[model samples]
Target chain A: MTKKKQPEPAETGATEHQLWEVFTQPGGGKPFEHAGSVHAPDAEMALQNARDVYARRGEAVNLWVVPSSAIVASTPEDIGPFFDPGNDKPYRHPQFYKVPRGIKV
Target chain B: MLGHRLSEWCGHGPILEEDIALTNIALDLVGEANLLLGRAATAENAGRDADALAFLRDVREYRNALIVELPKGDFGFTVARQFLFSVYALHQWEALSTSADDDLAGIAAKALKETRYHVRHSAEWLVRLGDGTDESHGRVQDALDELWRFTGELFLTDDVEQALVKQKLAVDSSSLFDAWKRDVTDVISRATLRMPGDVYMQRGGRSGMHTEHLGVMLAEMQVLPRTYPGAKW
Candidate 1:
C-alpha cells in the first residue's frame, strides 16, 4: 500500500494510456507465461483488450492482467546481488543429487 | 460481409492500437465466415464451393443481418453498431454451441469465446463514447438512434432458421430478443445513455433484402476473386 505507482517506460509508444501486462496459461496444468501487454483505462477493459490482443488464436485458456503501475520490478542493477546467490547454489537444483547404483536413475 | 465492413476501418481507427485491434477483429470474423460458408457449401448441396458461395452470391442471397450491412458512419457509429451486434452474436453463438450438428457446434464453441471478447471490447467502447464528453455523448447518441432500426433484423427469423432450429442445428434468434434488450438496457444505463424509443424497425435481411450498401461492398469484395477465377498464391 505504501509503494509508489511504478512509472511505465514509453517503449509501448502509449504514454497516455495505462499499461497492463498480460499473462496467459495455454491449458490446464500449464504455467502462465507472459503473452504481451495492452493499453486500457481500467482492469475490465484491460482484460478485454488483453484477450483481443493476445488470445485471439485460442492461445490461452486462462489470463491474468496486472496494471503496470502496480507491478514491482527489479532494475538491471539488482542482477548481481539479487540473483547471483541462487545461481551459485548448485545443491539447490534437483540434478545435483547423484543416483544410487541400484536405482533406475 | 462483416469482415469486409470491419476491414473498411483497417487503417482508419482513432488510434493505432485500436486500428490494429479492429483489423484483428475483422480477420477473426473472416475466419468464422470461412468456416460457416464452408459448411453452407456442402449443406446446401449445391455444386458451388465456399469461394463460389462467398464471391458469387448476389446481395439477395446473403443471410447476414442488416445491421452488419449498414454503412460505417463514424467512430461513434461503428462502436454503437458493433456493441449491439456483438451482444446478439454472443447470444447466438452461446445457443449454437450445443447444436446437434457437430461441425456447427464445434465452430460455435470456438466462436463463442471470441465473441465474448468482442462483446467486452465493443461494450467498453460504447460506455466510453457514451459517457465521455458532450461531443462524444451526442455523437454516440445519434449513432445509436440511427442504427437502432437495423437491429430488429437480427432477431427476425425465416423458414431457413425455423427449419434449422427444429433440427437443433441453429439458435432460436427470436428467443434471444428479451435477453438482448435487458442486457443492452443495462449497458446503456451504465453508459448513461438512453435506449431508443419503441418504433417500427427496419427488417428483411434474413430473406436477402438489403440496402444498396451491401451491393457496393459485394462489388469490391468479389472483384479480385471474380477477375482471377482460379488464381491462387
Candidate 2:
C-alpha cells in the first residue's frame, strides 16, 4: 500500500505550511460555502487566517478550514460522464411535474 | 490616526498577502476612528463636525496613542508594534463595550470584534517572526525592546480619561495594565521572545504633547484640507 502524506510540524519555523480551503456560513440559516484558501501551519492558524482573509468584510458568521490535500477531486476529463448524466435526468426535479391546479392537493 | 499609520504599509508590506492584510487592518482602524471622532465632535458641541474636528485639529490637539503614530519601521518592527498595540487595544475596547454611554458602547462593541481579529493576526506574526530564523528572531526581539517604552503611554490615564471614567463614558485606562501584561507576556513566552526590562516610559501623547513624528504626519494629513477649504469629493 502507498503511504499517505503527513502534515508538517506546526511550529512557526516549519518550512512547509499547508494550504487550507476556507468555507464560510453567511448566516440566516444558509449553508457553508467555499470561500477561498489560506496558508497556515495548523488548523488553529488556518481558521484565524481564514477569518482575516475571507471574513474581513463581515461576509461570514462561521468559518471552516480543511486541508487542501485531503480533498479528493475529479478532473475535467471525468466531467462528461461523471456529472453530465444529471442533465438528462430532468424527471428528478420537482419542476418536472405539472400540478393540476384548483385543488389544494 | 491609526488608519493613516496602517495605510503607510499599503504598498510597502513584505508580500502581497500581507500587503492586503495590513491595508484591511488599516481600514478597520480608520472606521473606528470615524466613530470615536464623531462622538467627540458631538460631545464638544462647539459647532465643529467630525470632518472639522478631524481635519482642522492642530498637532497638539490630537489624542491617538504615541505608539500608533510612530513611523512604520521594518516588517519585524511593524508587526511587533502592531501586536503590542493590539493587545492593549483589545482590552480597552472590551471595557469600552460596557460604557454607560450607549453610542460609545455601541462603537466599542463593533470595534472590539475587529480588534480581536487584529490581535490574533499580529500575535501570530509575532510568533512566526520571533521563532522563524536567527535573523528574524533577532530583528523581532529588537522591535519588542524598542517599542516597549511606548507601551506605558497606552495605560496612562490623565484628567480627560479620568473625567470620562467618572461619567461612565470611558474605562479607567490604568485598570487595563494587568490584563494587558498577562496577554503580552503569554504571547512573548509562546514566541520564545524575551520581555524587555522596565525602563523609563514615554509620555505626553494623551496631553497633546507629541513626538516630532506627529508634526510631520499632520503636515501631510492636513495638506488637502488646508490647501482647499470646503472642497467636496
Candidate 3:
C-alpha cells in the first residue's frame, strides 16, 4: 500500500545568531559613535562581522562590538516624558550668552 | 622588543590587505607595550617613563612573550603566530576587563577591542590559506606546526602572573588556557588544518629569554632613540 509522503521543509535564510551593537571611531581625534548592528556566533566573530559590515570603506579607526543582550538601553517611548521636563529649562540654552567677535562657540 | 618584532611587517606583507592589517596590529601592540612598560617602570621606581623603557632599555631587560619577538616569516607564519597570540591576548583582556585595578581594567577594556580584530583577521587568513589550494594548504599547515611549540609559553605560570593575579591586576594564565585552546581548535577546524599533536613546548619569554630574532629587531627599533637620547618632535 502506498502512503502519502511528507514533504521536506524549504530552506530558509542564514540562521540568525546573537545580535551585537557596533560603535566606531572614525579617526584619532573623533569620539566613538554608534554605528550599527551585526549578527555573529561569538564575540570574536562579532568583531569581524562588524568590521566587514561597518568598516568596509575605511570608515572606522576603532570598533567596539558588544552583545545586544549585554546592553541596557532606554526606550524612546519610556524616556520621552522623562526628558520633556528638561525642555522647559530655557536657562540651559547657550544662546543666552554673548561672546566677543571672532570667538567660536 | 615586541614593537621591534612587530614593526618588521611595517612595509612588507604579501598583500595590501594583509600589510595594513599587520601594521595596524603592530601599532596597537606597540601602544599596549608602551602602557604596560610605563606601568612597569613606575612600579620599579626607575624614574623612567614609556619612552625610556621602550627606547633606552637594553635587549636583556625587555619582558614580552617570545612569540611576539619572533620575526614575521611568511604570511602563513605571521597569521599563525597572530592567531595564537591574539587568542591568548583576547582571553587575557576579557578577564582583565573586570580587574580590581581600575587602570589595568581600563587598559584591558580598550585593548580588547583591538585584540579581537587581530584574532579575527589572522583566523580568517588561517582559514583562507588552509583551504585555498594544495600548496597554500601545505604551507599553512607547516607554519602552524612550527609555531605551535612557542604557544606553550603563553600560558606558562610564573611569579609575575601570580603577583599580578593576587593584586587583581592580571588574569590567571592557567584559566585562560582552556578558552584559548577551544578558540584555536575551532579556527583550525574551520581552516581544515590539523592541529599539531604531542610537540615539545618552548619556554622562557616571560623571564626575558627570547629567540635570536629579538636582537636584530631591538637593534633597529632602539636605534633612533638610543642615538638621539632626548630627541622629540
Candidate whose DockQ is highest: 2
What TM-score number comes out for model 2?
Answer: 0.84
Q: Given candidate 3, what's the lDDT at residue B47?
A: 89
lDDT of 1 by residue, A6-76 (tens): 33446556556788899999999999999878887778877877776788778999999999888898999
Question: DockQ of all candidates, in order?
Answer: 0.16, 0.17, 0.04
Q: Could you give the CAPRI-style class of model 2?
A: incorrect
> Which of candidates 1 and 2 is the stronger one according to DockQ?
2
Give the lDDT of residue A63 in candidate 1.
Answer: 94
Candidates 1 and 3 compared: the better one by DockQ is 1
Q: Supply the DockQ value of model 2.
A: 0.17
Error of 1 at B144 (Å): 1.0
TM values, all candidates: 0.80, 0.84, 0.70
Model 2 spans with C-alpha error above 4 angstroms: A1-18, A80-105
Q: Write the per-residue lDDT of candidate 3 for residues B1-233, one digit (tens) a residue.
A: 54455567767755443455566677888888877777777777968898988877676777777777887777788778888888999999999899997877888999998888788788887887787666678878998899888888888888867998898778778889999999999999999889899788998777778788878887887788888879986
Give the C-alpha miss distance for residue A31 in model 3, angstroms.
20
Residue lDDT tens for model 2, B6-64: 89988887654577788989999888988888998898898888888878999889887
Residue B155 lDDT, candidate 1, scale 0-100: 87
Per-model fnat list: 0.22, 0.17, 0.04
